[model samples]
Target chain A: MSERAAAGIRIERVVKIFGDVGITALNEVSLDIAPGEFVSILGPSGCGKSTLLRCVAGLDTPSKGQIVVGGVPVSAPPEHLGIVFQRDALLEWRSVIDNLLLPIEFRGGDSRAVRPHAKALLRMVGLEGFEDRYPSQLSGGMRQRVAICRALVDDPMLLLMDEPFGALDALTRDQLNIELQRLWLANRKTVLFVTHSITEAIFLADRVVVFSPRPGSIADVIHVDLPRPRKLAVRTSELFHGYAGRIRTLFEGMGLLKEDE
Target chain B: MNRQSLQGVAITTMTLIVFGLIWEAGVSYFGVKPIVLPPPSAILRELFSELPWYLGHAWFTLIVTLGGFALAVVIGVALAVLIVESKLLEKTIYTVIVGLNSVPKVAIAPLFVIWMGTGAEPKLAIAFLIAVFAIVIDTVLGLKSVPADILDLGRALRGSRSMMLWRIRFPCALPSLFAGMKVAISLALVGAIVGEFVSSQRGLGYVILSAQGTFDTARVFAAVFLLAILGMLLFAAIVRIERWALPWHASQKDYSPSA
Candidate 1:
């Protein structure tokens, strides 16, 4: 999607099972994400989208197959990859800036050098006046923004987001999606976001990968050739509806759609 | 002071004065001797006149209480960590600790005196025994109470085991640790007094015993009053330390209980 020659993530037939029960969480899932591209893995609940994301981030070791990031096999979480979880997961004890400083501290990076960058990233995410507030003082959406700033603070090469906006209300989620697109346009980091919302996957992703239900495998990969710098109005366009319909059809074929029909 | 606090203070002062007046009047009107049920005024005079002697005894009791409490905190927290870190150890030792806690610690005081002798050692041992179990149990619960999602975040961040403990587990467990300390502090005081009751030469318990032996009711009342004051002071100090340590706690935020 980015016209880059190098691949950011290359998952080759990854499989994961929990314990001796041999209950597969993910099976033979393989895909590649190009450098500086935005990809979304879309699926219903219990479809192992999260499990696959965790494997890519090296949070979970695949029982079989390999995951490579930036041409290196991922045995552990690399310092250059940033992950934002569904929950804000902000340290209650730390101030907003300190929360952003955590990963840098863990990586033994220079916080002094990164402090300005951290502030800039916060401003980009629309959190300029909230540097002193604790996570508890902020609303849910504001906290998620802090979490995003924290993820990007270390200047990571890839951003792996696990339903980062799933917990927010519709309006907040929509606002954040626009902000995310602007930030992505400027920063141009490779992103792999997991989400249950088809509209979100269609709107934000350069390409969307759909997964089948439990013991999941890749069902399809849909390329979104829609124009860049997407806005709220773009979500109401015919192209956006067509993309959503295609993802909906994939879910329907897999017997995963029940509630949103 | 606010009206409610002022009312509380007034009520407390009035209750104390009324109790003292009634005791004095009852002793005098009922023709009670100084040897039995002495008037509150006599006890107050005795308390002030022998303040130096009582202070020394108070210091001895305080030392034993604090020492035992420190020992309990160390041992309990270490044991809790060990158990929580290993499932096998938890399964084997948790039941044993519960069983030990069920036995009345006061009944074990004489055994401690027999094993450690009639000095501060036995008192310290008794106090440690009384305080340790609560700390261990509460701390274990606290450590385990850390949400799975928080631990997952640490894991996702690739935090090392020690990093996880220092950054996530320990801070999260602090409120429970303080709760355990509060309960243990009171028990530590009780244990020290109980130990002194069994076989001590220089504590409030010793003074009370000697006064009772000679039927000096006023001195007995004076010694009891000192012990109560000591307990209240120790409890208050722990509360102050808790406030200083956990300024972010909900209980510490704008909390001003009347009186």
Candidate 2:
């Protein structure tokens, strides 16, 4: 477990252009994420927020600038990095527990050694006894929970989530947001979460980084002074509403939401 | 099997019996000569009396079909992987396979006989050639059908190429591979019989040809009946293996008694 230390990320003036059309997906985006801080990137659809997360995960290489993780330059996927996608992406053929052990198998680690940790992660997410259920048999929210367990199984230092709970219903989304905040409080790993929901962003992050519409760069970063182990009731609080209102006003200023409409 | 499947079997058996009786009554009413078309009873008699002789020929054909199918699976899967993993093979080798597949396999059966003689080798080769196409095409589709997100997940884990192929792509392809095997197995049987028809001293195909020469309709009917039974059994065997191998697949649920 000594190798399970959290790693900070440095994204320095990253620029990404796609295809021959010169369509700029990300333009000179830069941010520094402290170790163990939970940062949510909030933006609208096609705002390149997901692309920024992909760059940090090393699934896409920026056309310009660089990303460094834990004092090492990113050329390929960095060590102990885990990622979760919006679709859950669980292998249907493998059972829940086996899906959790996939990263271990890919990394050439002993699966038998990681079985206990896998079960513990499942238990943490309220999926205590579904170890043998296939992904097809699970509900959407449950499948996403298993996906989260799979990401954490190898104890990745840096976790990147791209709209991980965006597909769920409103109630399930709130439940997952609370569970995710609890998990972060326990582990304190550096997490870079990308989402479009304003309430979800501030509820689960120490700082929410807002991005402008495409050719996306950071528009604003708002620090949340909310206390740890925050309950659902916190969302109704004055401070929480204040943060959401601020983000809405910013979007309105950018013409993303027209006041007349 | 459960009660429903057993009932299904019973219904199928009853239908076959009724169909056989209709054929028998029609032949007697028409006063058809045995040389034209023997009644079902005569064919049954011929089958029972010469059962050992039929078994010997049937065994040879079965062996040839199985050998060809096994070879097709091994080589076809390997070829598909190569084509998928390399753009060069996809452009060159895959195009050639598609072009050749368009040519009717029966047209080339005689070529195999001339090359490999009347032994089992020629029959095996023809069967493999006919069956390998389905295996390659379907396997290629399966290998390429893995979801992009799954591929990205594999990449994020820093998995090697072989690891991705083995752990992710291969298992994901199993259902499609089984579908190909079902088609290939039947094609292999057709290839085997075609090979025997072109040139052969043994097997059911030889029995049918010799019976036709002597105008022994009963013997010809016996061999034909055996061939039909063999094809069904082989298809059923493939289906059984598919069910066992892919319990995870959605198709299995449709036929499941509980579902």
Candidate 3:
């Protein structure tokens, strides 16, 4: 991040090793995200992008080095953390409103006290009337919207998403990206989004971090200087294509991009 | 084949009617003795005449079956949760339960009678013994059915063990739990009857036994019909509860008339 501590997350030479023989996933990867920054981690499959995000969320630990969030080392699940996975992790049994209240319930707080706030979040995400609906009743995109709201309802300073829109179709993914940008514009929560899509990373984030697979490490970092509150139109813009082209060439260098380009 | 469709109810009704008519015609045409092969009409006649007697015995069987089923649910769920939550318990309890189930329940019926006396306690014990296994096994399967991502969500959300169990595992296990209960309900009824067959002063099983001794085949047949009715109702009640409790489960999405 250009601004120190403004990204609100600092990863210092974090290394992750798996198994006894020491298969390293992330090798001494270090990054600093400024406060209220929207940073996307772009990587190929099996890259430590998700591992890096998980470290920040305290879902996974580093074998070496440290991850400090808001001046505190993340030893366990931080109380202020909100996570959204590729799959919409909504409890089908509960209504959308109830699912939104899950973190509050897990934190053992008065969930009912946050009812009005939850309803407002739903409205903001264009899901006002869908509060009473179950996850099954909602469409795929709709469910993801509910998921985003659930992540924000806890008022976490940092939002960690692992391919949150990867499961959706192209159109729905674009729609969600716009919605996410709008939400980020309004609240400015420091977001660490992990995705395989180069276009998505460039479209959504203030800064995009690219990773190399097999002992995953930061390959390249690109600063997206596009205007905020961006829409699908930004994806077709020449500057947006330039950023995507630069990231794609890095993948091509790693032999991940097919010759079809 | 849409066998679970609402129209399947019509097929069931028609099949029962056709079977009854066939039995009636076969007995009438062959002039078979009621003691050997009682006609459906003869069984119905016995049912009407011995309604009060059947009612009293049926009530005894019902209470015993219900008592056993209740204990099976509570103890089975508690045992399942214990096994699921603790690795040591999981290692030992599943084997013990399976081993206990493998023991010939018919053989144990008499032992229960000897230990618990000739009253309903013996029946209750046998019923619980027979039904609890299904509850434990099915609930375990249900609890384990939670997807890894969902479990990851819980962990990422900092969900405690109880929260995971009650909010995630328990609700997820309910459909399977009900499936187990449906099987357990029938088995519990059979267990109660088995106990009565071994030794009991009152019960439809006792009525059947006394009828067999007196060569009153129609009365025995009538007692059996009552038992079938009870089993069917209990099964239906369990299915009803499954639908009511887990309205969100995909299995309940069919909107069948039963739902």
Model 3 misplaced stretches (Cα beyond 4 Å)? A1-7, B1-11, B254-259
lDDT of 1 by residue, B1-259 (tens): 5798689879988998999999899989999998878888999999899889989999999999999999999999999888888899899898899999999999889999889999899999999999999899999998888887577667767788887887888877888988999999989988998999999798988888888898888989998888888887788788889978876565655633111
lDDT of each: 0.86, 0.92, 0.88
Supply the DockQ value of model 3. 0.44
CA displacement after TM-score superposition, residue B37 of candidate 1 (Å): 6.8
Q: Which numbered prediction scores highest in DockQ against the true structure?
A: 2
lDDT of 1 by residue, A1-261 (tens): 222232388999998998799889899988989988899999888888998888888888999999999988989876577789899888866779989998887776788888888888889878887787766667889888888888777777888899999999999999999988987887788999999999999899999998888788898999998888887898889988888888888877877666674
**Which pairs of residues collide in candidate 3?**
A6-A34, A6-A35, A7-A33, A7-A34, A7-A35, A8-A34, A8-A35
Q: Which candidate comes out best when scored by lDDT?
A: 2
**Candidate 3 chain B, which ten residues in sequence have the lowest lDDT sum?**
B250-259
- Per-candidate fnat, comma-separated: 0.20, 0.55, 0.47
* CAPRI quality band, candidate 3: acceptable
Per-candidate TM-scores read 0.87, 0.96, 0.94
Calculate candidate 3's fnat: 0.47
| lDDT string, candidate 3, B134-217, tens digits | 999999888889877788778878899999999999887887898899999999999899989999889999999989999999
Q: What is the C-alpha local distance difference test score of candidate 1?
A: 0.86
By TM-score: ranked, best first: 2, 3, 1
